[model samples]
Target: MRTSFSQYIRFQKRLLILYAAIMVFISIMLYVEPTMSIHFSNLLYIHAVALIFLMAYLTIDYYTIAKHHKELSSRWSNGMFIQDGIGAAKTYEQQLYLEMLQSVNDAHQQQLTSILQDKKESMEFMTTWFHDIKTPIAISRLILEQAKENPDNESILEEISRIERSVNQALYFTRTDHFARDYFISRTELDTIVKSVVKQFAKEFIRRKIKVDLHIQPVVVETDSKWIVYSLSEFVSNALKYSNDGGTITFISEEDSGEVRLSIKDEGIGIPQQDIRRVFQLGFTGTNGRVNRKSTGMGLYIAKKILDKVGHRVTISSKEKLYTIVTVHFRKGDDYYSIVK
Candidate 1:
């Protein structure tokens, strides 16, 4: 926007002093023509042309410098200058721009880091809170059992038991995200753990008139007992949830190569082909879940998480109208032979 030489010029004081010195030298040369030049007219003409060219060059240079400075200033105003131009800030404009950009980027990064830290802290708090709440729930269940004989409020007791189960599910779901920290690998008795979990569902099996077929041998393997128990429990619970009254559920364990596999099969309303793969996703309740509104869709997700932590894998297969089978494969290690022996 600055068109004139004086308007675009910077360091005005220095430019003016230099111009004045040049003019004074030229004037002195003209006055002492006898000593400086024989043809004074031609000399004066040449000097005038040289001074005009010098002024024109200065004006053009001033405009180029001013245009770049304006651009730099606009970029700073819009907060777009977030990195230096890979060189030292030589100009006054460049120095200001570099400092502004560095400050903006530093503040932005700090804010992002603080937000992430807050989220991590919140999740940690929830995990601890859920763990602490479970102790009281278990104690309350014990107290209710002791008092059940005196009162005829069977429904109330059942509801309390359901609450306890829901709380357990929630706690397990919360812990799934931190599974690596909780797993402890050791030799675990397959038969004992399976029997214990089956016993927990005895009342449901009886109430539904469902039969259980246990084809388990005294198999042992190196794994996390708590996680394995929970995983197997989830499979069994799912079987019970979908199986018709009088349907049979089968529990089997076998050894092959260097590994052990446990499977749960149920004569239930089987999953559709499309839904089998998605069942393990968090909060993904399939079509059957829509029919059975009580499904939280967290069970299998937590089961998979627990299994993976202890180096185990789970697979699901189902026949549309007949049955669903869940198989757990435990990894073989040096401890397997010793435990089986």
Candidate 2:
């Protein structure tokens, strides 16, 4: 807290020594050579007075520096660096530094805000586009449903179902960032969600002659219903895509230790051993996808993402050319968080 004045006083040893030498020389001259001046006594008296004044001046100066230093130090610490009481009200150099730092902070804050705004706008546009495009897909599905009486419309209906699934995937992917605000978490029955997903794929199941073994126990778990359904649908879609005619796809659920495990097992050409560990990677199409040519490689990736956000775990076990099982484990007391990427 010591000011420039106090620092100079403490550090001016050379000046003090020079003053002491001069005082000694004058006192010696006045005392030993009284004849050198008729006013030698007067000279000695004046010298004594000057010495007293110098001591008084230095004492007052030190007190001023210490007092100023204490006041400024307290203000500097508590004023958050930019308070006018600390900088602008002080000297010009301090005010200049304060303004420079403030400018940099403001610019940095503005840039961060701009980046977030752009990302939000882009997500909003994607959501709107997905919704708008669904209107046409819905009309097509309705037309295909009416044409079900005609034997020739089976293929078209199946194709439209695929299109609907793709659109749903995109819609959910866009909404992932807004899950905390968009989701409604509650006690949802496993059977209900499984049944809805199966119903959506009824046409594909029928065409492939695939059998569904649903052993869901109507067990209620706490989670976002819509998102859980979407995740289940992805597994079902994968099962249907890879399973052969007359093959069985099983949806089974069981609860243990206040946790529920839902498994979707299919007797499809399972993922190759080499690619099994990497199936969850975004846009990673493995050996099956290479063969099918229709795999976007996003189904399981998005499923794992949504499930992970809701505190659910997804894992896969498979034997190439035999079977594949995708399991979702739901736990208790998972609260939703609006995490930013």
Candidate 3:
């Protein structure tokens, strides 16, 4: 209880002492001057009795209010529920306070419900649109596969591939926010994820004349595979983008300090020192990005987002004209992902 019985005594003890002082003064008068002793003694006795009744009434009233306050405080401390109010109150003021609290709680619940419904609808629409658009994309890719061998169709196929990658980026970006709803976490092979992304960019690798080197050990890590694959693909695409024809891009994975680290190294025009910190910012196109007109400024941003969500770390180290290396580190447990891509 916030207001204890001792606290009440501390407040009213002075008044009690004053009453006693007055009674003692009357008794002294009766003793020093016995002519009016009967009258003074009887008056003192009646005052003492009245004082006792008044003290008792004040003590009971203070304790009752204090007990109620303590109960209400304890209940409110448990949670901010309007229903957990001063139930069965002995006073009208407490009942009014409870009614005010209930009104606020009701409004809060309604606002929360509306926000949730809006978010649900938005997620559904994004998912549906992503899937629906993929149907035509798949059909187009099939048609391109037949005509892709023709030299005249080479550049067209490349542009179409770029389009497909952009669409995939958007779809994955949408999914990243709701990772819990769509992804499964388990022991995923690091080499396997890397190989799949490499294969997806095989044509680009050939066209760019970029030499590929893979030094990945068969490391097992707890992660969401699909998202990891997309992240690696983004890294590989970036490597292909800035590298000179016949330049080397390498993938290395190792266990370091009880964590799994994967590095993608490219002999590409590197990120300017000033832009290094801002590369991960959404829609940020650095000096290298501006030179490479193909940079959407979203690849590294999405990659970093995905890595961070799954309990991974991404760091980029580079020299002006030499090379760029993007490293991702992951721990060995499942983590629920959030806010990425």
Candidate 4:
């Protein structure tokens, strides 16, 4: 109310000046024409009455401004459209400003829509290109497998495998943005995914002479199996990358109290204490990543995003130079169904 009154007074400064000028002219006329004898008290009374009426007019105008301001605030607070919220304008200038605002808003919305369409088209093109290139990669791998198993061929095959991993990583990263369209949630076996991921990384295991210690039991949970496999593959890949030759990598699974947990513990170079907190951050390669030179820094980030989307939890614990443990937790409940829906 005070704010509206202050605004009203500021806007009516010209009217106030004209009222003061009229009073000054009347005072001069009364003083010069002594024949029209108006007493001092009567002149004071007249001035008081005029002031009362002026104050009454100002009070009514202030109330009107205050009511308009309150209505505007209420409409905005309730999330009403700006054009409708402003209500009918009382002046031509106010109407003009409202029209101008609507024009700018329309232009802004149109530009935003165009930019989103362009982005959607670009993502679709990249996704198609990745799928097309994977066909050639698979054929090459097949051709090499059927050929004689020479050292040169094995090396070439390893390079091809690396390329395939990179392509899969890029493809999955792009799809994360549109995950709602591609996923189907169902009850999937946990050990099956673990075994499949371990098999996928068999070459890396053989090349590095790393021992696999599996202590997995039959465990099942509700999830999108494809995404779970990809996320687990990323974790296994990280384990293989940092493990020393002939070192031990353990895969442990446990189900208790309606909760399932899968843990991958590696006796490799563990994460630095300072770097542990930011390991999942996008493109953040810590001390180990810099030494390894193969870490794209998107593996953990992508895995975490997929896990979060599927309503699972992943955590990491490590002591530098000792061991690193990555664990994924799946809670058993109907809430899992709510995630995809």
For model 4, what is the error of residue 162's alpha carbon versus the real structure, in angstroms, after optimal superposition?
A: 1.6
As a whole number from 0 to 100, the lDDT of residue 23 in candidate 1 is: 73
lDDT of 2 by residue, 1-341 (tens): 45676576766577678888888887777767858663767876877897898778777756754665576687777864434444333446556866787888779879999999999999889889988999998898788788778887888877777888898999888777777777777878778888888998887788788999989886888788888899989998888888889999998898887689999999989988999899999999998899889688899899888988777888899997899999998875555443212
Q: Which pairs of residues clash in candidate 1, taking residues 3 or more apart in a chain or in different chains?
A: none
Stretches > 4 Å off in candidate 3: 1-101, 148-150, 287-297, 332-341
Q: What's model 2's TM-score?
A: 0.68
Q: Per-residue alpha-carbon lDDT of model 1 for 86-173, expressed as tens digits?
A: 3456568768976887788899989999998997898788768877887887787677777877665455656666777677777787
Model 4 misses residue 92 by how many Å? 4.1
Question: What's the residue-level lDDT of 153 in candidate 4?
Answer: 83
Error of 1 at 145 (Å): 1.8
TM-score to native of every candidate shown: 0.65, 0.68, 0.69, 0.84
How much is the lDDT of residue 13 in candidate 1? 69
Give the poorly placed runs of model 1, Cα more than 4 Å off.
Answer: 1-109, 149-152, 334-341
Per-residue lDDT of 1-341 in model 3, one digit per residue for the tens? Answer: 48877777777787778877977786677667857656655776877787789778878878887887777787778874355445675768777876777788889989999999998899789879878887887787778788756776767777778888888899888877777677666787888888898899888888878788999998897788888899989988888888889889999988966789999999888889999999899999888777767777898898888888777889999998899999988865544443222
lDDT of each: 0.79, 0.81, 0.81, 0.87
Tell me the spans in candidate 4 whose CA falls farther than 4 Å from its real position.
Answer: 1-86, 90-93
Could you give the candidate ranking by lDDT, starting with the highest? 4, 3, 2, 1
